[model samples]
Target: MGQKKKEIIKSFLLTLAAIFIMFIILFPVYYIFTVSIKPAATLATTKIELIPRNVTLDAYREVLFGFKGSKISKNFTGTIEGQAKIEDGKLYLTDGKITGAIKYGPFTGLKFEIPVSGIIFDVSTTENFQGTLKGEIEGLFVLTRMNDDGSIGFGIVREVELTSGDVNGVSVSGPMEKYVVIRNTGKAEFTAVGKFLNSVFFGYLKNSLLLATLTVLLSMIFVVPAAYAFSRMQFFSRDHILYFYLMFTQVAGGLGIAGLIALYGMIVKLGLYDKLPVLSFIYAAGSVPFNTWLLKGYIDSISPDFDEAALVDGASYLQIIRYVLLPMALPGIATVAIFAFIGGWTEFILASLLLTEKNQPLSVWIYLLMGGIGRGIDWSYFAAAALLFALPVFVMFMLAQNYIRSGLTVGGLKE
Candidate 1:
């Protein structure tokens, strides 16, 4: 009765721990999407709003289109006798006595006209009226003008210009130039974040897929034969060779392989450096010993009766392996494939050492973002990128969880 109570208590504690772990894992995912959807202005404010008070599409627009601002200056050269009218963000000449009125389009050529006594004046063909009436006024302008004939001008004015006016009232002169300012106004925070995420999400994803597939295929090729040899064939120093391979698993680390690779290069005289296929071979080589042992254990668990039965049916050793043992060891093969895939997928140290900048895996790419190009770390985009990087591995684990569990159980129990 006391043992039963202990077991029940242990199970309850395990359930509670699982729930806590799940919540901890999910918190960041919830936070990222929430921040992505947040408005720029609200993000700038101090108090955090769990639920957005004012949902806005401006953030998305800024990320896609970018923000633009312009500084426009209007220059005038004429005679003014009276005051100017300022209404609705536009300057209009009212009681001004001028010899002529000139209108200049924003970027077009200027137009000049003569006004006589508050009326339109048409002077004779070469008449130069030179009564020096001077005045000046300057201010910012927006595209808010809409004509009665259905023409639209500038939009809303974001900033007002500082103005200076002279006593001449007719002559206005200041630089009339517009300076447009473009800025990125998205929650992405930094451009590198997007690039890094892209590298890991798509770039790393492709490399990892290719590397994993090749690693698994090659590992199985070598592992199956070696396991079969160790299980059935008799050769000199076979036990010693198996012991050496088994001992290889306890080596210091990957750096030790550098010497062997160097020797191989001297003998072969081939440049395999920074190549993906070469890296895949290295990965397969490293994984082969453990995979061989794993397969050997699974094969040993299968009664030799199956192979003998196939042999009596006139099957050769290769045919027995192909037709009988291989099929029965599907679960174990899958387990080996998963191991090789994960190892290659997450293998960073060797990839970083061997691959060049362009050929580097996503893991190496992610590491590059720590402090390259003289730019500091951008956490927001980094977080987003990291989430994207982890997604595929997470998906793989979820998809293979059943097979992995069964394979592990079978291998453990049988061995």
Candidate 2:
């Protein structure tokens, strides 16, 4: 072949190789996604299917809502100011002020009016205690029966303002505080992503978000100044201190169970065990050394000429760093933040050991999903949880990817 033809062939081959590699890498992820949606009956079929023959979101539902029971009763907890008025034997709630307070359950936005038409089997309550009143919602049909009072029951009840974004066919579980039974017995089955999100798992998600963010903020606080000092200043035992940091990083990595237990004991003594900030600080402490090292390398590559210029302009060392070095080191700072966040986001073993049940991060739940591996286990749920757990990390990385790439590559530039 001629030169141009040969180059074209080479490019074509490289493109094909890249496509093949991408397929090999992503096929398993796609398969897992399919498996996660597969119905319970077809979860362990002998036949292999790239596209599941039957797909149901019960696993994801369980992950989000933590309620796999047939009943779909959810509790709404908050302060309310609305008056429920009875109109034509139908209860209608109007002008209600609801405060957001969810001690339990994933109902952060449980604001609504009980539409007049929603009141079925309308029986007037002498007590205005809507707190634990039970109501049945029959979206499909009306059930009419004679009560002890010899009155005909109003058969069908429906939400006039059905959730603009309601789960297409959420299951009706056991009775709620107010007998608001959602009878979805004859409805079309659909994904319960909404149900899952409005669950306790969402609390775990919130906890992880808080921890990871605090870890990043705390890591920046600890790493930036130290890295700048190490990069720009020459103080007493500076070299020794840098070496000590390097040693600490290595030692922290190699710390075994004994070290963990000792740390646990110290946490107990300090009475900081199971606290979110304590775990965040621990993550930041571990992150600082590596992040400092990374930032130091980036800072070193930027000449001290900027510091000299700032000094000539009557700026102090701190001012020079704040104005000049910090702006220049934005990418490096982002890289460090990414590292700290990933450390906290994915740290399961340490979190489980140090945190309480309610305070534990999503990492604990992620690990629990895989605990049943190698047994009569459902791998689909594990896959789903793993994917969801890694989603935030993926998003964080995407947000900071350019910075990380540029931060690491700056050191490789020619003078």
Per-candidate RMSD, Å: 17.7, 11.0
Candidate 1 C-alpha lDDT tens digits along 14-122? 9999999997897767665455454433223424446745555444333232222222223334333444333232333334433222233332222122222321222
Q: What are the lDDT scores of the predictions, listed in order? A: 0.56, 0.64
The 10 consecutive residues of candidate 2 with the worst lDDT sum are: 163-172
Give the RMSD in angstroms, all C-alphas superposed, for model 1. Answer: 17.7
lDDT of 2 by residue, 51-78 (tens): 6877788777667655332222233332
What are the clash counts of all predictions, listed in order? Answer: 15, 16
lDDT of 1 at 345: 78
